[model samples]
Target chain A: MDAGLIFYGSAIFLMVMGVFIAITGRHLIKILLGIDVFDTGLNLLIVSFGYINGGTAPIFSKYPNIFKNVVDPVPQALVLTAIVIGVAEMAMGLAIVMQIKEKFGTCNIAKLKELKW
Target chain B: MIRRLIALLVSLYLGYILYSFVYVHFPFGERPLRGVAAHYVENGIKEEGATNIVTSIVTLYRGFDTLGEVTVLFLAATGLGLILAGMKREEEEKPEPTLIMETVTKHLFPLVLLFGSYIFIHGHLTPGGGFPAGVVIATGYFMMFIAQRSFTPSEYLLSATESFAGTLYVIVGLLGLALAFSFLDNVMPLGIPNRVFSAGIIPVIYIIIGFKVGSEMTGILLHLKEA
Candidate 1:
């Protein structure tokens, strides 16, 4: 329970920090850094869900065993998938930033002119 | 100004509606999934001849869903590749990382790759699985890229691995279609549990996925850095 609070609190903090970066940061890289913070927070929340008290590795030995020692692997797997997706998203974001710089000669957020539909 | 005000009002209304509808965490009075999973476990090992129920469900019973998910990834990678293909990294005024990072990354990279491959191979018996292992493997390459100035990965090798893994995945699915009852049907010899060849084609399929995902990840990182 204590861990849950820590996880959720940090998740909220990182998410808010990310929003702040995206909203007010002057540089494009700073915005990407903020997004990474948000992603890390989400990954931490996911890992916390798979947390079991005193849980060990999920390996089985051929005999009777205590089941409480193994936290769920599904969430861990899901986090892995999410992390890859995050990489792809970040890459695309950076790629666009590169293109923007080529076209506009800067990565300043205030200088963006292609914001409209 | 009036348009802005109207848009704000609409957004507020929608936000409130969304807040009311989501994240309540109420009891749904549905049948216990725990019981269902437990019952499935009791009977599944006998029926499927596999100890790991998660592996069984993912590979044997719900194989089609896994295939769809892989295909989704394949599509996403393809889409992103098209968008970012010619994109180049624009590093402004920043000095290269220190000599410590250079020395440490070059020396420690092999160990990291070894650990990642070990995780993928032992995934069926252990907590770590393919996706995480793939990322770890990719990270090893990523670390090399970051530490060294001219250590760009081979795009030809990466694309080949990606295509090979994806094609093998579909081939396995079609084998199930041809010989077995359903798609991705687990027909390979299920060796002794906890052994290297155990879990039949499940581990093989996972390895292929790991290869594809790792290569795609490395390729994306390379493209981003080079772009």
Candidate 2:
């Protein structure tokens, strides 16, 4: 019934799906997609936490004095940074995957176990 | 199938734990934000001269964090370059793009570039900022690469702009240290809020960040293509 509950529930569901994909997927790209999904879920969770019942954005362009019912901007800022970092991490991950494919001639996690400690 | 089932079960358990943790700790949509958030919302506009509270927080209150974030991006780009350095390039014949598509791409590229610059320039006064703008610029270049398959972006130009932007960011931050209180401080006069040139060093930093991110992202995309 509550919107917050629904939002959080969906976020958790996506996170679970992401974890399952990460754990069960064989290919490197699939694992990367899983991580991206997980990142999205985390961002959603953060933005949802900052939500108020009927809060506007924390910008002051429209209503300078509407501070009483504004959503928290901290999470939004942090999420922005996190999203950029996630992209960089994903790019690097894909690059490493390409290298692995070049060297090992495959992208399967099982095949990559040779380098495991 | 068994491995997938086990993974599903583990994920469900982890999800349950996370859900409970969130439910217990953060009562979503119920409580008021306290401490730093409250302070930012209250005094951000006055002090930072940015209507967008999030922008103020990202560039003014916690600018050092943003610097670190940019460094992380730079390192990732460098790492990608290093990893793909040894790959041999093979020259292959590619199909020529249709005249219509080429014309459309040529027309749209400048528009996309303009929009990206607009986003970065008006970051302090608007919702969009440097990161998104940089990605948009990279997208424009990507479209160009696709349309004009033989057209190679000047690597020297991309690197030059990237380095210049990065150095300028640091210099501006250092200016803050020398002139103002601390690192990345708002040393310049905070002009009228909601204007293009307001928000002191915030827009300057964001614009530099935009240039750096755009060039680096384009480089990364180009590198991946080559790889």
Candidate 3:
């Protein structure tokens, strides 16, 4: 019934689903999508960590009780950085995937025997 | 079948661990604003003259991290370029965009660019900042790419903008080191809070970051498209 539990539960559920997709996905693009989902879930979890019961954003334009009511700005800032880095990482991953497809003429992970451990 | 089973087991284990850890340790919404967050919220207005506490923290209090973040983005873009460089270019005839798309893009490009600039320029006061603004600018460019087949963005120009913006950012940091207390320190006079041009170096830094990120992203998109 608690709001915190719902947020955490959904985040965890998404993360688990992402992991499953990443592990089971045969297509390279599917794996990439799975990773993206995982990244989103993690970002959501982090932003949720900064939530106060009824806190507003951490801005001071026209809000009263600035200190008492503002949510944690630190995690929000860190998440901003994280989101950018995630984009960069995704770009790099997709580039690698593109190269793999060009080289092997396939996007299926199961077909890439050389990559198998 | 075996792989799916393994994946299911692994995901189940991960979910169990995460759920248990979060349930036990973090009570989520009840988290009080304390520690560094409390300090920033308390003194952000006086110290940085920025109403947006997150902006102050990102641009001023923890600026070095931002510099590093930008460098990582640069590296990623460069790496993508390198990885895609060797592909042979095949000139395939592409269909022209629909009339509606062209019309909408022609009418919307300038507005999107203006809105992006506004978001970054008012980053210190508003919720949006350099990253989102830069993405918006890149989206505008992407629309241009999609709508106009002849619209080829000059690679040299994008690279030049990215490099110039990156260099300007470092120069601003060096200026801060020389004139102020530390690198990326607020050397400019902090004007009245909650106004445009009030956050001193914060807006300037955000603008530089906006340009840098925008060009870098455009370069990556171009590379991907060409490859």
lDDT of each: 0.66, 0.90, 0.90
Give the Cα error of residue B90 in candidate 2, in Å: 3.4
lDDT at residue B118 of model 3 (Cα atoms): 95
lDDT of 1 by residue, B143-219 (tens): 99888887887789898999898899999889878887677877777766656677777788778877887887787
Best by lDDT: 3
Docking class of 3: high
Put down candidate 2 lDDT per residue, B44-141, tens digits, no spaces: 88899999999999988999999999999999999999988988656888788999989999999999999999999989988989999999999999
Can you rank all candidates by lDDT, best first? Answer: 3, 2, 1
Q: Is candidate 1 or candidate 2 better by TM-score?
A: 2
For DockQ, candidate 1 versus 2, the one ahead is 2
What TM-score fits each model?
Answer: 0.74, 0.96, 0.96
In what order do the candidates fall by TM-score, top score first? 3, 2, 1
Chain B TM-score in each of the candidates: 0.80, 0.96, 0.96
lDDT of 3 at B100: 95
Candidate 3 C-alpha lDDT tens digits along A1-117: 888778888887888889999989999999988998998889888888888888989998863446468889998999999999999999999999988888889999787889442
Give model 3's clash tally.
Answer: 0
Q: Per-residue alpha-carbon lDDT of model 3 for B1-227, expressed as tens digits?
A: 98799889999899889889876877877777788999999999889989999999999999999999999999999999999998876788788799999999999999999999999999999999898999999999998988988888899999999999999999999999999869999999999888897978999999999999999999999998889
Question: Fnat per model, in the order given?
Answer: 0.09, 0.84, 0.90
